[model samples]
Target: MRLESVVPLIPAELVAALDHSCGIRTDTDLLFFGSSLDIIKKLPLGTVTLSDLEKFTELVAEQASVPGHRGDEILAGSRRISEKHSQASCGVKELDDLVGGFGDSRVFEISGAKGSGKTALALQIVIQGLLADADSCALWIDTSGDFSAEKTAQLVRHFDLAVSDKLLERLQVSLGFNIEAVHDVLDALRNSLSSSRTVGPAVQWIVIDSITPLLLPSLSAVSSQGHAMMTTFMRRLRELAQTFGITIMVINGTSAAAPFNQSSAFASTNRKPALGPSFTFMTDCTLWLSKTKDMPDSEGPFSVHVAEVFRSRATRSRIWCTFQIRHGVLSSTIPDL
Candidate 1:
């Protein structure tokens, strides 16, 4: 029998089985699943019931799934079974020991007041990824217009990339000031990826140096509508992260309203940074950077920024580490606190 003809005859139980096994969500429409009729031909006749088919259709319409074991519960059970099985990444040994490592398909939000080493960290990742020779390319969306060509050149020189000046030429740098422009650049990037099987090195990382400014103008009202818009924007970012299999690093600034205990914290609060409750929740990982004041005589005048990893899918509990930018390379000075 032709697959197309059998589509209508397939039982609901068979459809449900296909959906669960194929990771098809319940909301998938007939038109979408109809294309997969070929795969439905393998089911035996009379094995599935019309009632089961109806249930499957209903589930698809409602975008509901059969309840089963929760993922978190499974992980907790496994962790209990094997105490040494931690999900942390292979970050720099010392740093990774504390906050774990960056995870694949995750959005990491780094927020701090100005001059808080956010850009430095972003640059560091770009250089490190290049050094790792993961065939990795980086997309740096300079939202603050602070990305420096000279600085990038300095880092390239400092690390001494292995690629010839010609292949190194493939490393593209895009600069954008407004959100629309940034979106346009991203669209171009997506198109490039679709058009060519091997267009430059496989892009593995994307950094938006300071996403706050791009979102600030639209979030002035902070109403439900505004929040919805913000959510949509973040969803797009998440989509890009997944589609390209790239790690997304967004630099965010804190708002003035966040409560502060010390004079320094109060001063930081006055900077009028971005504010949105969902910002913290939507991110897969969040790192808060704050300046350390009243350092001992041994420490320099430069504000010491400490990194705290909060809300990560794969990270360590060792929070609190110091980072410094030397010779244009951002390096961790002390291990975990």
Candidate 2:
């Protein structure tokens, strides 16, 4: 089936030649409708005709221009479209209630300074998914060289999640040293998910532990180009979420607090994330982790970490919760709540 032969098979009247300069507008609507009507009349009726009618109506709605009529037609005849994905518990009841858990088909951001338990949270998300289903799996892209198998196993054991060979086989881990490596890993993951018909049911979560390291190399050298690249990468992550019906968690490191200078007020506000506006704009939810000061003495083995949901589209109220990490497992600090 050569393209040339296929082209000749199409009705010459339907095909527009390069030299044809006629505009498709109100003046030519009748001619266009006549051509389309003739083509449809040739097709088999019943199912094909009914199925195409809806698509044709949508096409007409897009190009319609009957002063206020387009809105009415679309509203009355068309259905609202939205991405579909399942929601899973984030291992903490308060956080789950705050943001409706980690929503599939959405990008969630966890930003914080060093030793803020960002990686610990990400690993627990994987464990949670596995706990939900024995066969459930997750992908971890370690851009910061901090992913630990020992920690993962400890979390699985402490949480009593699936720890069999089959469960381990389902989980996929890839090390990404640089931005190019990260892109390559994402591409490979996308292809694998696309090829497998049952990927959505098998793979439940994907985490990029610390996206800041991948951008640090170019942040000072080519600021504009670096931002553009970061935007592209974030967009791709969003697409992967929507297309695969999976939750995406990206860990981002924040900038160091500026030296206290009484002369400048803006110096104190420099505690934002490293990548800036583009990264935050793409995420559906952004949570920041900060170490709490002067906590009451407790006999617990692990210290408590606080999470603040500063930006989120899923919930209206501002939320803050305290959780603890012990032996790689995470749990709410307040047991009564």
Best candidate according to TM-score:
2
Per-residue error for 14 in candidate 2, Å, reads 33
How far is each candidate from the true structure, as Cα RMSD in Å?
A: 11.7, 12.9
Clash count for each candidate, listed in order shown? 6, 0
Q: Which residue pairs clash in candidate 1?
A: 12-52, 12-53, 26-60, 98-318, 99-316, 100-316
Task: Check candidate 2 and list the clashing pairs.
Answer: none
Mark the 10 consecutive residues where model 2 has the least summed lDDT. 18-27
Candidate 2, position 153, lDDT: 69
lDDT of 2 by residue, 1-337 (tens): 1111123333233233211322222212312334544545544443235345345434443433223447775443322212223436768886676666776456889887777788888777776676676656788888757677876766666666445444566678999988767767776676677674644445668898878888666654434545555655676676667556678898988765456322112233346566765567789988777654423446545667777775787765346777776555567776752
Q: What TM-score, to 2 decimals, does candidate 2 have?
A: 0.67
lDDT of the structure predicted as candidate 2: 0.62
lDDT of 1 by residue, 68-151 (tens): 678897566545523321332322444445545553556788777766777777766656655565466778888766778777
Q: Which stretches of candidate 2 lie over 4 Å from their true place?
A: 1-87, 161-164, 196-201, 220-223, 257-270, 293-300, 335-337
